[model samples]
Target chain A: MKEYLKRIYAMLIYLFLYAPILILIVFSFNASKSRGVWSGFTLHWYSELLKDRQILSALYNTILIAVLSALIATLIGTAAAIGIHNMKKLKKKVIMNLTYLPVVSPDIVTGLSLMILFVFVKLQLGFLSLLLAHITFNIPYVILSVLPKLKQLDKHLYEAALDLGATPLEAYRKVILPEIMPGVVTGMLLAFTLSLDDFVISFFTTGSGVSTLSITVYSMARRGINPKINAISTILFVTVLLLLIIVNIRMSGNHNKKER
Target chain B: MKSKWLSFPYLVWMLIFIFIPLLLVLYFSLTIRTPDGLVFSFDNFRRFFEPIYLKVFLRSVYLALISTVICLALGYPMAMILAGNNFKRKNVMVFLFVVPMWMNFLLRTYAWMTLLERQGLLNTFLTFLGLPPLNLLYTQEAVVLGMVYNFLPFMVLPIYSVLRKIDRQLIEAAADLGADQMTIFRRVIFPLSLPGVMSGITMVFMPAVTTFVISRLLGGGQFTLIGNLIEQQFLFVGDWHFGSAISMVMMVIILLSMGVLSRYDKEHEGGGLW
Candidate 1:
């Protein structure tokens, strides 16, 4: 009886979680524009979504920002992780705590503070400001991911590379970089995914003209019900799902390999 | 290869981006713009004490607290089930809990607008069952529901992870001592899971307290939470000083609550959100 009750409760929770999404998915396929009625199935909305220039541009901007931010953050953060890894205890503590600040603070605080900084500095609240904000928030995550791998790194590996007559830069490129490649990749992917989904900071930082996919969706949502929004979200939902699945499979594969 | 010089670019970047921006906010919050340019004053902080803003702050706290409670009530049992039980798809089940969170949260919140709208799913079901179509959206209840919906995973994942790490031997020892399931859970499981519970509360409460999107779309225009207030200050009203003050207060609330929770949480485990 208890087991049955638990199963039923789990079912209810899953239903609660997925019902809205499932409804949206189902509604996207409905021929009718209104959510209330389903007048047979059609790909009308998805096709409309394909042709929507505004959304496509938003999508373009989202990918562009995410990719650029992730690439830049990965480079800087990997280097910082290595540097901080070599630091004295007190200095490491201070820098690591600073790193945690953006992670721990509410998005609104970060968003508003960055907005003020941009205004004070006289930078326009557009692509550059948005990129700056993304990079700021993203570095901590990259550092956190990379720092652990640095901890796990063999201490003498770089010295061994240097002893072989390689220069300091070459030693880092050949030895240190390869050793932390997994962490770097993980951090970059994480930064990309976060930058892609981020809305709040982007909403505050982006000026009148700029819009990521999320910002566009927010406006479409606020403007009222549009079947096109439903279609767009469905595509986004599936894309994220697929990305996660691929990552999960790879992670499990790595876990298996490590066990071996 | 691990030279500290490598960190120079990053430190400079952080100073310009993260640290200095925060200091600028502080500078703005503590001073007012007068005829002589920026004059130091506590006027922004004082304005936050006004009843209207105070009410918004309280409502943000009240709703977040209620959402946190609801999440705990719903989430604790779910965590127990996930940890304490055996299932073929246990990992998959845990992953499902986090999957919704990974979906664009804005889209997820907007999805609620569909169901809670007048001719939406819930009302359609209600009307089919001969019930009155309720004014469900743009209300306090809707706001709380959205909060719970958005944050339930934040509560569950932490508690679930902590619960999973409880030593099985202790439970077995309790069973050997003639403790029933309920007693074992209360004495052994629940106590061990308190750290997770604390972290879970911190996770849920922080976001729930700071959310502007849910309250805006679901609670409608009239429902002004602290997040909305700060958003208006920066984006709409252009009152950076007042916004900075509000942001400072919010950070204090979050940090204080976290400190208190962590004080109770002796052995800090990895919080589940990461």
Candidate 2:
């Protein structure tokens, strides 16, 4: 009886976590325009998604912003992580803590503060501000992901490179960069995904001309519950799922290769 | 000198981007907004103590607290099941738990909107089953559900990590000594997992309190959390002074919670709630 009760409880929680998503995935193929009940299955929504101008444009904007933010964040974050890693003296731990402040700080505070700052500075509210804000918070994520790998790096390789007359830059490019590339890749992917999917911070920081996918979804979802939003969500779901699978396979393969 | 050159760019960047902006927010929070620019007044903060504003503030705290409790209640058992079970699909389950978190939160909440709207899936199913259709969206319950759905993984992951680290032999010994399942769980597992629970509580509560997007989208702008209030002040009303005051109040609440959690943590675990 006790075992039965525990099993029932676990099954209920599992359903709670997964039922909505399962319903979503299933209804993406509903043939009828009605989202209420399951109709005959069709790929009409996926095809409709292919031609959705607003969604496609929003996707374009999201990608552009994410790419720009990730690139900028990766450079600065990796540099900061490396610099802090190499700093033997001073209150490096304190600096690390401050660097992580943006990560731990709520997005609302970050968004509101950035919005206010943008207004105060008279900066044009557009892609530039969004880019800056994304990079600002994203650097911390990159740092957190990359710093541990940097700290655990084999120091002897760099010393050997230097002993062989390579400059610091050359040593970094050949030795350090190769070793930390996995962390860099993971951090970059994380930053990209975060910036792409972000709603609150982007909602505040984005201007009239720029609409990210998340913002567009929010707007459409607010304007009286459209099926197009569901169609678009299905597209996003499939895309994210594919990327996750690819990343998982790649990471696991890399892990096995490393073990070898 | 060489090291200084290496660090100069970051120092300047941090100074310009972080330190200065933080100071500016602090300064603006103290000053009052006027038609003729600004004046040094505590009026903004004074307005924060008004009944309506305080109610909104307290409501947000209440919502966050309830969401944290719900996540803990649900997440603890899930984490235990995942950690203790020798399952073939453990990796897949872990992936399922985490991967959804990467999905656009707006889209997820929107999906819930579809599921819960009056003319939507839930009502349709209810009507088909010959039951009354219940409208669930745009309510406080909806808000709490969205928060829990969004943050459950955050609670689960930390607890699972901590639970995995716990030695299983201790539990076996307790069972061997004729301790029942409930006693073993209460005296052994629960105490050991408090650190994860505390950290998970911090993670969920902090974000829940300041989440405007979830409240705005899920609550249909009917209910105002502190986050929504802050957003309105800056974006809708264009009143930065009042917004700054609200934001500061929120910051104080968050800091106070952290203080309490850290104190509790130190007493319980000999480490702060880092």
Candidate 3:
């Protein structure tokens, strides 16, 4: 009876969590535009979504920013993690606290602070600024992810490589890089997802002409009922769902390998 | 092996991006620009203490607190069940909880808007069941519901991770020592799980307090949280001084709360939204 109760409770919680999303997926196929009543099943909204220029442009911007920022952040953050790992305790503490600032600070404050910085520096609030902001917020995550892996690394491995007549750069390349690859990859994936889903920071950092999909959806949803958004939401949901499944499968596969 | 120079690029980036921008916010919060030059003053912060803005701050805290409590109550049991040794397919269950969080937060909040609005899906279902329609949309309750929905995973994932890590032998030992089931849970289980609970509260409360989007969509734009206040100051009101002041105050509040919460969380077992 206790186990049965637990199952029922879990089922109800899952329903509460997914019901909203399921409604969105179902309504995207509704012939009627109104959210209240579904007239019939049709793909009209999806067809309409294909021709929406604003949304397409925003989608393009979103992917571009996510990719570019994640790549740049991974590079810089991995290097910094190594550097911080080798630093004096006091210096490491200061830098680590600074890294934690963006992580712990409210997103609004970060967005506002960055906007202020851009305006003060006279940098144009466009793609460059948005990209810069994404990279800025993303680096800390990468650093945090990679730092742990660095800590777990065998310290003597690089020294052993160095003793084998390899140069310091070659030793690091041959030894340290591969050891920390998992952390670097995790950080990059995290950065990509964060950049992709971001809205508040993008809203403040981007100028009039530039927008991301989240911003577009916010505006559309704010304006009122639009079935086109439902279509877009359905597409995004499925894409993320597929991406997560692949990633999860790969992650578990890697875990099994590590255990072996 | 001790190459510290590789971090130089990141350090430079942080100086230009993170450190200086934060300093600029501090500067703006303290100074007023005039025709002659910038004058340092506390007027911006003083203005924030006015009753109108104070009410907004209090409301944001109140709503965030309520939502965090609700998430804790709802999520703890689910996490406990998922963490149970008897549960099958725990990985799949945890993944199900995480998947929605990975979707666009705006769309998730907007989904609640559809369900709660008058003539929406929930009301339609209610009417079908011969129940009186609920005036749920455009209210504080809707806003809290949206917050709880969005942040519930933050509470669940951390607690679940911690609970999974808990050694079953301790519970078994207590049971062998003649402790009842409830006594075993209270004496052995809950104390060990406090770290996860602390981090969960911090994680959920932080975002819930700072959210502007959830309240805006569900509260029908009439509600204003601290997030919306800062957003309006920068976007619409064009008042950076006051905005920076509010941002500064919020930063202090969040940092202080985190400091207090971390006191209880001794292990620091990676409580982020991974």
For model 2, the superposed segments whose C-alpha errors exceed 4 Å read A1-8, A42-52, A250-260, B1-8, B176-178, B259-274
Tens digit of per-residue lDDT, candidate 1, span A1-260? 98889999999999989999998989999997767767899999989888999988898999999999999999999989999999999999999988888999999888888888898889999999999999989999999989988998889888888889989989888888987888888888889888988999998889868889999998888877888988988998998887777767766775687689
Q: Report how closely model 2 matches the true complex, as a DockQ value.
A: 0.51
Models ranked on lDDT: 3, 1, 2
Which CAPRI quality tier does the interface of model 1 achieve?
medium
Residue range with the least summed lDDT across 10 consecutive positions in model 1 chain B: B265-274
Q: What is the DockQ of each candidate?
A: 0.77, 0.51, 0.77
- lDDT for model 2: 0.81
- The residue-by-residue lDDT of candidate 2 on B1-274, one tens digit each, is 1132444456566666666666677778899856897899889899998999999989998999999999998999888877866566888878877877877777778778878888778899899999998969999999999999988888999899889988889999999999999999999988988878888999899999898877887899988999989888888898787888888777777777777877777876675334
> How well does each candidate superpose onto the true structure, as a TM-score?
0.97, 0.93, 0.95
Specify the highest-TM-score model's number. 1
Give the alpha carbon lDDT tens digit for every residue of B1-274 in model 3. Answer: 5689989999999999888999999999999878988899999999998999999999999999999999999999999998997767877788898999999889999888888877888898898999999998889999999999999999999999989998888888999999999998899888888888988999999999999999888998889999889888989999899999999998899999898887666444444323
CAPRI quality of model 2: medium
Q: After superposition, how far is residue B236 of candidate 1 from its true place, in Å?
A: 1.7
